[model samples]
Target: MGALDYLSNFCTVTTTRTKHKAMQTVEIKVRMDCDGCERRVRNAVTSLKGVKSVEVNRKQSRVVVSGYVDPNKVLKRVRSTGKVRAKFWPYVEQHLVYYPYAPGAYDRRAPSGYVRNVVQAFPDHSSNAPPQENFLSFFSDDNVHACSIM
Candidate 1:
């Protein structure tokens, strides 16, 4: 068989296009005490491919990354920067310590195992003076009759 005949018998050609996944936002909770910790976490996350933006909130110790990157991969990358305690945002919620699931704590119709602290305001019965008009007036303008002076 000639070269053309041999090639036709042994090979086939096809073209395929890969569809890139849409980018998504991933929020991670990292307890960064200072600017260095925040910088490290930011650098680690931004280094990943397809990262669109990185937002760091030092007060809340939160990092928000937007891109086509996988969340798990981003988490791994952040942890690789010597931060072993990194966790997803929702997983770090304050009430999660008491209730792992929303239905357990957040749901109003759920059982009573959820311990939610509710504050009820009770007017002081001892005071009928329409409450102190200026609570701060006690400290700001020291009264000559102040009991503490004694």
Candidate 2:
């Protein structure tokens, strides 16, 4: 009986260590529009066992969970909060969707189906190539000091 008890204890410890080593972090994209949406998603994920932390970014529609948790389980829990279109965060990044194998999407010559965006790190050498410009920067006014002096 004592030998059996010792064996069981050793098995339990080994399994626990394996589970801890398998710990992972998963990022999910959830379309949370308001405080209620964010709260629902957060609450659902926080209840999962081995979950160390939960972060929700409504503007980016992102939820990041960290701890000894199963990624699939975390995703399912977030979806159960009335979010049906939940997906892994990487799918939402345009670069990964188009040029996944390329490093940093730095090439000026984009492959087929590439989503064009400003801030191209490597501009094409062709003379006709358009200059790189951040689309968002056009609308931003960075001359705050100039305006303040006026």
State how far residue 121 of model 1 sits from its true place (Å): 23
Q: Report lDDT (CA) for all predictions.
A: 0.71, 0.71
Number of the top-ranking candidate, with TM-score as the measure? 1
| TM-score versus the correct structure, for each prediction | 0.54, 0.51
- Which pairs clash (backbone N, Cα, C closer than 3 Å) in model 2? none
Model 1 per-residue lDDT tens digits across residues 42-90: 9989889899999998876678999898899999998998989988774
In model 2, the runs with Cα more than 4 Å from the true position are: 1-21, 91-150
Give the clash count for each candidate: 0, 0
Worst 10 residues of 2 by lDDT: 110-119
Question: Over all chains combined, what TM-score does candidate 1 have?
Answer: 0.54
